[model samples]
Target: MKTAYVKVPFQFKFEDVPVPKCGSNEALIKVMACGVCGSDMNAARVEAQDWQSFGHEITGVVMETGENVSNVKVGDSVLVESGSYCGTCAQCRNGRPDLCASGTGLFQWKICGFSEYMTLDKQCLIPFDPEKIGYAQGTVIEPMGVALDLFYTTDIKFQDDVAVVGLGPIGLMALRLAKAAGARNVYGVVRNRKNTARIKLAKEFGATDIIYTDETPLEAYPFPAGGVDKIMVTAPPSVIASTFRAANLGAVIAYIGIDYGDRGTISFDANYFHYKKLQLRASYAVPALYFPRCMELIADGVIDVDKLVTSTFPLEDLEKAMCTLRDDKEKEIKMVMVRPELL
Candidate 1:
């Protein structure tokens, strides 16, 4: 088996290693397609101290099932939920498995989707129809699930005005899901002209308006004085401050972006939130329970996952793909690694 490891900053070395043997409750999945996530970029940039394995948004076929893994059989197509949670944790007891504190190190040490094969517990697998959704489309379920979590936590209703900050994959997915969920007007805030093409596609997906921060101030948008009813921040910490500024007094602010900094701060009028009763919420990856619903949505053709994918590369070109995603931001959206032979 061949695996790509981020041994150090900006360096990826491919090594041939023994294939992992599945445990009694785990299944061995042959990687079909894996999406390079923004978090993977953060990992490659040495954001975390551990030697993190790349690729989490993934779709694969079950090659071998363990003795007790009856839910998934050999040849079943499925999407792997990268985040793990202990079913008995306090957060898990409250039905928020994504925040399970005891399962904090699942992505840090265990195998990731970057390899030719991934060993996942039965709880992390969601069966999907490969005929209805391609491998590229299947790989987006994780990010889409994250977007779904944002909407699930808020009190958004039909025709509500929503603004999504940042045009990353998750942000774009939020734009699409918000509109699908019945938002009247959807706005996308982006910093670079690199996302112009994606912004245009966002319109097709659901965005009614697009705001490029490089060209216009957040306050100058056409929204009312209080601004949008809800704002989802998918950009870095710097942009999140602006997202807070543009949000309506009583609006919901969902922070879905991953920030590594601790120095940035937002200065907002406390009375605004107190008088209007604003809701500030932080959302991470989707809960495991939502995976089934997300998979059904994808299988039903309600959300077009294929359009979110901008490019696909062979597994051998992992480094080149990373560079293209890092340097050529304008030319790519979501990049997937496909194993042609395995398919």
Candidate 2:
């Protein structure tokens, strides 16, 4: 099988590697589609040390199952949870596997979903209905789960006002989820003209207002000071400081952006937070328990994952896809690589 891997910073190569054999408790998944994530760009920019592979958001078909893998069988369509956790870990026992104390987490290394075939532990697979959803939609389940985690961290009421300080794919997902959760007014902030199109889509999905940062200053927005109940920051670290400055006091600020190196810092008014009792929280990947609910939400039509997809590429074009994402942020939202031969 030819596995696509990041050989060095901004360099990708297709290496002919031996197919992985399923372990007793693992399953062999034939890659269907794997979404190229923003974090993957960060990984590609950093020099590759080991023969590491770089994708986590994946959806595929079960080609072979290990002897002990009964949760899913051959021909089952599924989304990979990507984040591995030790069942006995403190966080896992507390039903918050996103904070798994185990060393098997995705943050430690790569999962290599951008390949012809990938093997996963049985516990990391979430079976879904493929007839209703395509591989592109399934591939985004992981990121959507991350968006759901932001809501889980904050108190989101149906009538509350919410704002998202970025219009990336994840930020767009947060916009959609907020509306689905019955938020009265949802706002999306973007700077680029292309991103403005995405923000408009947010309005179609559920946002009541799309704030183009380039057109209007954050302070000039109609939302009053401390008017927003919750805010999600999805912009890169370079823009986060200003985004944080605009956040309403007493609002729940959910930081979802992954800082790329030391781009910049976020400055907050300590006095404002102290007097207004603001809650600042950071949300990473979603917990395993949330996968089932996220899948259910997709199944029930609460989230249209397909609409968020902007482009697709073949696995062999991994480098091109990554370059497009890194260099042309304004043009692309989410890009997914598909391995049709493997499927």
Candidate 3:
């Protein structure tokens, strides 16, 4: 089996290794497709480390299951959860599995999904009806779960005016979900750029307005009822403060992002927040909830995964795919690489 790895400032390569073995409680998955995430590009640029495996957004087939595995069987098509909750955890017992403290996997397997075959704990596999979804669409379930988490976290109300700062795939999904949930005005915020691809899709997916930060600051955007009732930020931590300025009185702000060093810290107006009775919530889609719901949304024609998945590459084209995603963000929304033979 061949697996992808990256190290140093920007080095990436593939190495042949023995196919991973399924543990007593694990399942061996024949990876069919994996989506390249923005964080993967960021890791290649900023992280310095020894050669390590990366890609996580995954959809695969169950080739084998350990003796203890029963949730799924061989030949079952599945989407791997990047995270899973321990059923024994206190939070799970309290019916709040999303907050499970002992939940495992920021990414399920040590070997990663960027390989021909990998083994993971059976708990991370969510079996889906392959007849209803294709491999490429399956690759998006994880990210859709993320968007759903942000939607629920913000508690967006019907007829509420909303602004989604950062028009990445996740941001686009967020805005679309907000619109489907009945938000009156869906705003997709982006930095000034000429690539109208994202801006145009935002409208197609239900964004009522596109706010280019350089042209008109989010704080100055004219939304109904004084300002947007809800704000969802999927950008870096730095954008949180200015994005919050667009929120209406008593509005809720939900954000999911990560940054290292000084860039991780953000400063916003505490007095203004207090006076406005604003609620700020952090959304981390751990335990990777809502896969089934996301799949339903995709299958029922609500999400239109084909529109968001702008490009596909075979596994052999990993380098080209990564470069396209890193250097040409304007064109590609979500890139998925597949093993055609495996598929």
Best by TM-score: 3
Q: What RMSD does each model have against the real structure?
A: 2.4, 2.6, 1.6
Candidate 2 versus truth, CA RMSD in Å, comes to: 2.6
Clashing pairs in 1: none
lDDT of 3 at 75: 97
Q: TM-scores of the models, in the given order?
A: 0.91, 0.90, 0.96
Give residue 92's lDDT in candidate 3 (0 to 100).
98
Ranking by lDDT: 3, 1, 2
Query: Whose lDDT is higher: candidate 2's or candidate 3's?
Result: 3
List the candidate 1 regions with Cα displacement exceeding 4 Å. Answer: 48-50, 88-99, 102-105, 224-226, 263-276, 286-289
- Judging by TM-score, tell me the better candidate of 1 and 3: 3
lDDT of 2 by residue, 239-270 (tens): 65455445565678777776644564666677
Residues 160-217 of candidate 1 have per-residue lDDT tens digits of: 8998888777788778788888988888888756766687778888787788777988
- Looking at model 3, residue 313 earns an lDDT score of 84
lDDT of 3 by residue, 1-343 (tens): 9998877677888999998889889999999999998778777877637777888899999999999999999999999899889999788999999998686675445798778898988888999876677788788889999999999999998899999988888999999999999999889888887656788889899888788889988888777677889999999989988876787889898999888889999988799989989998999998789987998888778898888888888877888888876677787788898877634
